[model samples]
Target: MKFKFSIIFSFFLYITYGQINVKGKVVSKSNQPLEGAAVFFNSTTIATITDENGEYQLTVPEGKYKLVASYLGFKTVEREVDINENTSLDRLNFTLEEEDSLLNEVVIGAKKKTKSKKPKYEDFLVFKEAFLGRTNYAEKCKIDNQKALKYYFDPATNTFSVEAKEPIIIINRDLGYKITYNLEKFQIKDRIISYFGYSQYEELEGSKRKKKKWKKNRKKAYHGSLRHFLKTFITANTKEEGFDINIMHRVRNEKHPSDSELAFSKKIFEFQDKRSVPINFNKVIVKPESKLDSAILIHQRQLKHPKIIDKLIKRNVSYSDISYRVEGKVYLKFDGFLKVTYNNEPEEFNYKRDIKRRLGVQKSNFLLFDSPQEILPIGQIADQNNRLVEGYWSYELFANALPLNYKPPKE
Candidate 1:
């Protein structure tokens, strides 16, 4: 009887010790206080956004809780913790990995155009038009100024460039900006004449290409006639309006053994596709929490890096021409302003507030800044107002020409 009573008492003690307050300060990789970091456990609404000091306080009934910490432009962190009563995890800090804005860089042959086949220049121009046309998509109505930038495509090198006129990133959902352009935009420089060498894409039917790959994959081709139609659709019309965007996403949780976890333990994503349609992934989805609202998920991802490249191409901002070779990718020059929090003294410019002003001016028909030549001017304007406007002035050309037979191997 005595032994049983002792055992029961110990169990009660263990239960009592499990409850506690978990307190911590969330800082960025640079040791900067991460204000507004979302500290939550699992999918529960039991959550709190970090304070201006990058500090948070949470009460948990000890067990294993999936602790997620996130901020804009930063990677999302999911951690497991077992707490005890009266335990104060003071300085329990979270570090977020910075995101690489550049997507993929490839190189393709920059060959001359020939008459027997479609000139490489014509394909390049078609690609350019499809890329630029994406900017005009209706999604622009939902743009957020702070996260928005003008993307330029260089025709000669097939590089994508970026330029920012404003410094603030708006956090509203309908107003939040997207990361990549809906499609690629091509800029034309000097015309290059070349014959089509390979018929890589000639096999795909037009309708098949138009349909989402996932959808087509799920529903296999039924009739030979349908398959034939697909082939014709993709190849029949060289003059057909061409545009496509393909974005692949993977969401992993360590608890879920089937899916592999990411190395360095942060969210990693890459969006690259060679389709000829304007696919803005603006309404994109991220996994495990895909069911969760995007505003919340994307907002959490933003903590690491506040500056996200606008994938939407703006003809007014992009280079006048662009073309790609098979297996080639290019990086072009960009200039823009970055908004940083003031840990020391408040810089004269408040990026969050200034973004609105910049947007307002643009709406009022004010030319806020120019490109290449005006890049310096935009930064000067932001600096004059006491804000940070770092220029993205240079980039490398990964590939000037991409092969017609572009196929991304299965992951």
Candidate 2:
């Protein structure tokens, strides 16, 4: 009798100490078992991952508890249940619904029509018009660069080049010691090609003499900076904000334009300031229409490359019809550039002057010179030969002349 009582007590203690098996299967709304689902009790105490069969088990004290089932891409589900000391739970199950990606859909029961929303003209047009004129100047100029090494194989040779990147913008001209690396400081190579593209203009014959004359008459130069030239050209030619059909896209079976026809067509639509406009136009009529059998997308992606136009030309891109995608971030303005290359090489010396709109002092004003000149002050070199040598640092200029506190021109 004593032995039987001890055995019964031992059995009772074993039953009390044993854990309550909390078993369940987590599944999605589609009734498919979620293999990597997580199951937890009271959000923390007991946690377990679902098996390949979406079944999970957690040994917990026989008490009331909350169970949570979670999986990626699905809404979490929770349940409250009671557990007894000697109870076995039946097939516990969880059903999770896929999380709706668009938040508005959950509250409204359906996605609202986003197509009806007004199109943002500032996203595409304003910057396009502002920078396209630079495209024009670049296309007209003969891009050429010659390395001016005063002495060969000498440390003091003063190696430099002379050329303006496609756009004759002062910022695009680069002349100086091509510092390739720096140990203590982060070495930077001035990248200026961000400004110009294959422009819509003819190469001027006898450009060398013309450039010389322009340099001699710096004060009387028609455009103060390449910026001014481009801004003027873009504003003068483009009356409306629309894609230029000729330069941007190749129309097929369309009304063939006459030789005197304007390549750029003004869109009749007028956009209001701070007001959204609808994007409505045939794809073919879009400024940047993709060619059926071309790599325009590839080229646009690689536009950040220094020699993009050269690469595009190598890939059979037509100089006249190379599409200029006006897609860019908000009004990109560069402080200045250290290097400007044309015809695939760096320029030696160039100079461009910018007037401080408020001060308007012609002399003793900010003279935007090459970075080399900026580092080596020309005034300090007093000797004639030394001054000449220091002054020999020629610079090309690609600048946008703007009045201080410039407001957008009235259309």
CA RMSD of all predictions: 31.3, 34.0
Show the lowest summed lDDT stretch of 10 residues, model 1.
1-10
TM-score of each: 0.24, 0.23
Alpha-carbon local distance difference test for all models = 0.32, 0.30
lDDT of 1 by residue, 14-38 (tens): 1122546778878888889889877
Across 183-258, the per-residue lDDT of candidate 2 in tens digits comes to 1111001211122111111112345666554344332222222223223222332112211111111123223332
What does candidate 2 score on TM? 0.23
Clashes of each: 67, 24
Off by over 4 Å in 1: 1-19, 86-88, 103-411
